[model samples]
Target: MITVNAPYAVAVHEGNDFTANPPHTSIWGLLYAQVKQADGLDYRNILLNESEMKLKPKRKQDEIFSTFMQEAEERRAEDIRLNVRHPHKVDATAIMQDVMQQMTIEKHNDQSAFCVWSNKEVQEILELYGLPVDSSLSILCVEVFGQVNNTYEHIDDFAINKSSLIKNTEKEFGSEVALEYNRTIDVVGPQPPKRPIDPLNSHLGMHRILRTSPLTEVPFVCCTD
Candidate 1:
């Protein structure tokens, strides 16, 4: 939690799978929380990408998006459990319903979505600035590409590595199916490069972990020392 000093900005990003029924995203910004003052502690939340920031038009949008994300998360968890347990009796319909219930609970928990700062707008803005849809180094992408060319080339090199994904699936399912998947992935390409972001900078100067400044400050309070 960063202290709100005067005013600052924060970057916004959309959830990876915003195409889902309920959309979700994130807000990256500087938060300031000031110490004691006449007007109470100062607080400020500044949008870094103000130009491209998209505020949700309808209040229900938040509800829908929150529900979708929670349900998806729950379903993902269930999938993991099923994969691990290898249950003999599988009820797809029941699993879906349970996940839906979880989504509904999430929606009810925050109707106003007052705490949600991320949305699709931010994601679009980031994309406009050439940030890849699925990038791990979001901050660096914003700082380097967003500042330089405003277009960071997304490079993906596929190479063949240990067939963990296929092997795992095959173990859970069976050898025949796993072999089919393995063949498919092999057709796709090879394993990824050692450093994904290494291509971003050809000539390295100083590799610094980009970060937003924590703009929080506490003023001096004097009583009787």
Candidate 2:
């Protein structure tokens, strides 16, 4: 059970039915409550405007909604700009170095060139490296080099390939690091298929991971161990 102390709390308790005649006091009250609960003054102002508009004539409600939505969108755009300008302190260089090092070590030990790090493992690595323990960092790294499966069982495991990793490293960490990393790993391209592969025909016995290059718009195979 949950308890709300505000006078408009009942509006939220009994949900608003917008279809009803003489629009429910619920919308007005709810907007008022949202205005009070809003974090930023700009957002609060929008909510306050919306709450006041709810009390106006029915014909004007649509205009209010349109205006309010525009303001909300502008606010969201401004927030995104601010965030891009001042992102979290993530040491991409250090993180990439550690990831490459780990991948190399794993390849040498197991004869497997690919590395699949689970969400838990990635978080642990972040902590161990004295880096910020942000889950998005794991997603970012995985997205740069691999595809994340949609299924629940494999979704947490990020399988990163060497080629894509190097490509992304070059893009993000500069040519010097990328060149050294590529040389250190002894980069080898995967061989082409003998026959034309049909994706729908699973029994054709050709199983390859395909990744498209953003710059070239060309598809290439990502070799596994």
Candidate 3:
């Protein structure tokens, strides 16, 4: 019986009352705030009403501080969880090469400015150019960047105890099982079998898993064609 635009619908449903109160699209207003915040001209401290319009005559110091602090805290939390808030459009490989060239100075820059790569950036670069690079070298590069950035401050706030892994198992099975549990966690598992060069199934090539028959000690390939 009643049909309005999507924006109107959102405004109505998201607010306390569509007629008396309405929610403002603060995200749209964020562009303006970003310009001000980045420009270091955030003196006005525009306060949004329930309808999202700027409150007149600017906000008080306490309100401005409170709002800015809350925003900063939220952004910091997001950066920790996400690693990178904004993805630079620059060529990552080229940047990595340049950074690697200026390793000493670049390391300092990363530490001071938090120039660490985001998870998305890392994944994207690796997917594009990972095949030629050795896995160890790739890991080392990331480690160096991580050390410089120290971006895990939020995640590191919570420490994980090694004992927590096997606490329950230790009670039930004693120290030996707990030691084994630790070993299992620390030890590397067996690697997959090398894929044979089967021209017949060349297109279907994959890292094959080794499996053994119940009655036999011999192993056979158990993956792909």
**Candidate lDDT values, in order:** 0.37, 0.34, 0.31
The total of clashing pairs for model 1 equals 16
Residue-level lDDT of model 3, residues 1-225, one tens digit each, is 101111111213654444211111111011000113456856322211111112122234445445545655676677777778563333444444544445444322211111232334433443564222111111100011011122112122112544564687799999999989778655533333433232113322332322111211112223321
Best TM-score among the predictions, by candidate number: 1
Q: Which stretches of candidate 2 lie over 4 Å from their true place?
A: 1-160, 187-225
Q: What lDDT tens digits, residue by residue, belong to model 1 across residues 1-225?
A: 111111112233573321211122222232122223357665323223311122233335445555655666676678788795643334455555665666666544321111122435434544665554332211111121121211111211113223566678788999999988777765645433323232123423433333333443323333211
Order of candidates by lDDT, top first?
1, 2, 3
Query: Total clashing residue pairs per candidate?
Result: 16, 0, 0
Worst 10 residues of 3 by lDDT: 26-35
Candidates 2 and 3, the one with greater TM-score? 3
TM-score of structure candidate 3: 0.17
lDDT-wise, the better of 1 and 3 is 1
Which candidate gets the maximum lDDT versus the true structure?
1
Q: Give all TM-scores, in the order shown.
A: 0.20, 0.14, 0.17
